[model samples]
Target: MAGGTVLVVGGGLAGITAALGLADAGRSVTLVEARPRLGGLTHSFRRSSRAGDLWVDNGQHVFLRCCTSYRRLLDRLGVSDLVSLQPRMDIPVRSGASPRVARLRRSALPAPLHLAGALAAYRWLPPAARVSAARAALALGSVDPDDPAVDEESFGRWLARRGQGPRAVEALWDLVGVATLNAPAERASLALAATVFQLGLLESNDAGDIGWVRVPLQRLHGDAAARALAAAGVRVELRTRVGRLPTTYDDVVVATGPAVSEDLLPGDALDLAPGWSARLGSSPIVNVHVVLDSAVLDEPFVAAVDSPLQWVFDRTAGSGLDPATGQYLALSLSAAEELLGRSVAELREWTLPELGRLLPRSRSARVLDFFVTREPQATFRAAPGSRKWRPATATRLPGLHLAGAWTDTGWPATMEGAVRSGEAAVASVLGRRTERTALGATA
Candidate 1:
């Protein structure tokens, strides 16, 4: 299979990683993307306002130190310098119920103990609830996310059985779960939730340390990837849609969204019932971007509790806005089912006062501009029994593979999952090639 032609039918992180890995392995790779730009769901666009033209990302995407694959992809893209990782895992969590801000900063202790200090002192939960939460976290460490029984149960139900009340869920579990899983604890699977908590928080001390892009996502991913792919001698076809799988390539990687993949793949390719993609479903994310007359939020980002606002990020630096000008903030609202259909005016009306409540300075600051970005089908719905819908990398059809966050990457639908899926797809493809070569040699 040396010098074999490989066709990757998506320009996302998954497809890009697969293309690069294949090309580097001596395959003639061609990446086809229907979008004009390469960075699939994670992209940026220009917005005009009185302040100036700003580059706004579709959503505020962040990564953790545990996300080795995504970070490696960033290094490969040569844009590692364009992002910033925290020296320690520190999250400024603010609650609307109280004026005081709580911090989820990890200490220099060992696994589980590293966060004990922060959890013990958390003001959001009662003293007993905090202890219960800690105990539940320890219990979660023992829960194998790969088990089929775990996938059948909901995280909320599991937490409830362990004495986690609604307060603990809202103040603690859902704080991280909703953002990562894109579904609240009641609806999210225990398996996916366990994976996020164990790998991100429990397994290692520094694994949960946060990192975010310093520049626009397009520049960090799409543009950098385009340059990297070109340098690697991989052919890229932007704005090219494949209605049906091309038979010419030695192997094909369908790395698009589940719906798109379903459309392109042969009916018999996957071992699933009809309408699996539809059954897998999707969740929505609504990003409310606001420009103020003056700076309100001091930190780079802050998580919210007891309010509709989820996470607020200071986008002044990344949006290309002048410091002298007002401030730009983007509020990332995950599991935003109700807010998806709300009008911009309605969002502005509701969100302004909420921001004022969270950040008191926002009440006095005049709004320069306010807008919204919605991703209805953001990620595959990580509900209970979702694993059954997510197929493995290899399909029943030979030389055809699947690569996406929706694939069976043993992780949630994050940048890490997408990159891991791509790597897995590459391994599957090359592994099959080696098997065939060995068989031929034996014959």
Candidate 2:
């Protein structure tokens, strides 16, 4: 654990964090990644164009200010300046083209009281629903995420029992739940939802303040992490696939996706259950990127209600789009199983009009180009009983361990969970106690 080589398979945030943690602890680390770059799911690409090539992220990843571990990772990589956190929690939420943009803002008050004004004034929900939302939020703060019964029920069912109806679920619950849990409230586990809501919104005043990278995710995660780890004397291997566990290292961390980890992990080496990985089913996410002739959206980010647009981010600067020519916007659709098979042309036809509806400036602006990015198995489905499938960092095989967002970190499949799992894996390898870092949630 002190000096022997520790092999970390997968170049994701989880793998990167583990490698860095190990190397910092005076242990020789080798990070093997199947992809050419470091970032696994969170990456960027170059979009060819007649004018010039543009840098675009594969998916939009948003984090909260309370994500201390991820923030520490950023600091370690020396890319902390590449991202910015909002001054406070202010979400521009639109419900169709109602001309009324509901602002979900938080005050500087203590927990639970910080959001009372925002919730009371939320225009999307009726007055009665807003009252019920307060009650429900308070109730969520009391629910324990570790209880087996909590994971067995859907957040929607719990909210319904607390007087939340369809309108409230759509305007309030789904608005936040679907984006975080990657599923609707009706399908997401109450345990995960409770963790998201309690830690993110109810526990602290600044926990929900949003932060996002100003540059491409590749630069922020993959390239920066690679540079950081290599400088620490860590052996970095890219575009390398380990079909079987290599016996060269003292310890190996299987940090790949859930299904891929199950595949790469030797059957006879560990005493894991045969159906363990299978139980953590996957959920899909679809991202629609559009370049328009004008800056339709003024805000950096926005959330939608009663619209196909779940969340939209203006990536004009990040995408290297010439402000004088056109603007670029990326729309993230979580739990996007229905839209996975849709063609880009079909998606463009509908999404453009929806954008125009939300932003009147887009009504007359011409669409320069449109494209879609799909992740069929983006994250393990955080539905009912998912906690039972999530394994701990330690495995039966002392030489091999696990690390990924799918593992139990008391959070959903987000950047925070990925980093937390990595640290946990490192702690397991070092035979040290794991210290829980501060962070609210991730995308």
Candidate 3:
């Protein structure tokens, strides 16, 4: 397994990460992708506008400073400077329930203590509820993410048992949880909730600092990854779908989605359990892109509460839109079931008023263009008992491994998880030897 040919299927972040790692380790690797470009989830498309042609991302994706693996991938791809991290952890939140806009920014302090100032002044919840939220955070920090019992129950019920009211869930937990876990507290697993909170918030003050790509997603992920992979001397095959196992390679890594993985995994060779594929479900994400005559948001991004808007990002600069003409805003709605089937016109009609309500500047701004992008199966639904469905990187069949966000990486389905899954797969493949992975240590 040291220097033989390795076939890595799927050109997404996971495949790119794996291919780069294996090639850098002096292994001959062939990377194949069904799509014309790389960066499976994080991609962009061209949209014609009166101002000029612009590149709009499939969705507005962001990562936290805690996502070390993904940041490492960026650094490896030589595109780390293309993204921007917040100077400090700050989130401007606008709630339809209240007229006042609340800011969730950290102070100069240690872990957990850094958030005290922001949460104390958080106007979304009552003073009593804020205190309750603090207590809940402390309780959540104690819940070990690795505990199996924690996955059997929903996070919403746990919050209720701890005296968390509806206001606390919407204003505090779901505000962060929905974006991170891709489900409401009632629907998400307690294990993932605890993991997101403890690792991103409680572990360190800087962990929750948000980072986003300044350029188009295609530039940051697809194009940059291709450049890095080529420079690494890995043979890349695009627009080539791998339906069957190739005999040219000694080892193979399936880095596709769960549904795709089921089709690609040879049942006769791999002793997969019955209905193993059905165990992992899917979730949807809806993104609304709007081109306005003028700027509405001063900050680059903001989270919304008591409204349909989950997170809104000002992508004018990212989209390369002409500032002299107007601005471009992308509204990201995770776990978007209701909006998935709706037409773009219908979505535009509904979201424009909401934008107007949240940003007074948008009321007078003329809508130049509006569009929507939907990922029906954006990621596997991280429901209660989902952990049992997720398989390990090492498969029952030798020389065959699974690498995707759906794989067991402790974290949920994210860019960080995807990259970690690749690293884990490489670690499993090279575990027989004493080779170190690109992630630094073994496995």
Candidate 4:
């Protein structure tokens, strides 16, 4: 087990974490990735505009204070200062159906009770529905996310059974579920929804405090990782595609997407049935970037209800846009099944008018630039019965493991899940090596 050679495929957060951990443990690790960059899904690109070269992220990704593993990865990469976390959780919610803007800010109280005041005063929901929502939240806190029965039911049906009507689901449940789960309550599993609520809201008061990157994702993740990997003595091979699993390495960690992992692993490596990756499915996310001549959104970000706009974030600082000249905003559209097929021109037409209704200042602002970025396979679809498709880190074949957000980490497909999968894979690899060494010594 000492100084064993390990190969990590896919240079995303999972692969990067595995490589760094293995190298630090005195293992010779080689990280390979097909893409030219390292931060797989979370990346950025430069776009030419009249204002100047604008840095645009593929998608707007945010993490919570509860995501310790992901934050540790950021610290390890030496880019912890490049991101900012909220002093406390506060979200400015705007509904196109109503002119009033609601706030979902938490107070300095304990779990469950911290959100009581916010829920009681939520302008989107009726007084009766808010009370019902609070009761449902408490009921959900008790649901075991690891239970097989919980995975069999939809969150929406569970809410309805607990007296949560359409208004509660739309105004309260969907507000959080759609952004985090990447699926509506009706399509999302009760198990996954319970996990998000319990860990983020019910379990602790500060767990749901949001954090986002202030710099381009590329600089924060990929660039920093490259420097860290080099210092760790891990060999990094970018733009290298491994058609078959290499036999030379003592251990191999397949950290690619489900489809890619399935193709690379041995037929009998995993215990799951055939076509499990396909059954796992995927969800899409579309990001619309808009540059205006004048500042429209005053806050850092805002969530929308009863409108096509899901979440709008001020990207001026991150994109290096001159604030004096204009403003840059990014609209993050999750579970974007309907908008995926729409043309760029069609999106601009529909989005501009909607912005006028949601943010009145946008109506008079001159349009400088408008573009869209789409990820068809953004994340694994977290629908009912999805846990069966996500396998454990250890494989049937010895010395082989899987690392990705799609794996069974008891969490949804998120950055935290991805980092946890990598850590688990490393643990499995080292644990097996120790077992083999013990057997040899006894012999």
Each prediction's number of clashing residue pairs? 0, 2, 0, 0
TM-score of 1: 0.97
| lDDT for position 345 in model 4 | 100
Candidate 4 residue runs with Cα over 4 Å from true position: 434-443
Kindly list the per-residue Cα lDDT of model 4 for residues 202-315, writing each as its tens digit. 999999999998999999999999999999999999999988776677888999999999888777778888799999999999999999999988898999988879899999
lDDT of all predictions, in order shown?
0.93, 0.88, 0.87, 0.91
lDDT of 1 by residue, 286-343 (tens): 9999999899999999999988898999999999999789999999999999999999
User: TM-score: which is higher, 1 or 2?
Assistant: 1
lDDT of 4: 0.91
Which 10-residue window in model 4 sums to the lowest lDDT? 434-443
- Least accurate stretch of 10 residues (summed lDDT) in model 2? 434-443
lDDT of 4 at 358: 89
Candidate RMSDs in order: 3.5, 4.9, 4.0, 3.4
lDDT of 1 at 36: 98
Q: After superposition, how far is residue 256 of candidate 3 from its true place, in Å?
A: 0.4
- Which ranges in model 3 have alpha carbons more than 4 Å from their true place? 268-272, 433-443
The window of 10 residues in a row where model 1 has the poorest summed lDDT is 434-443
Clash count for candidate 4 is 0
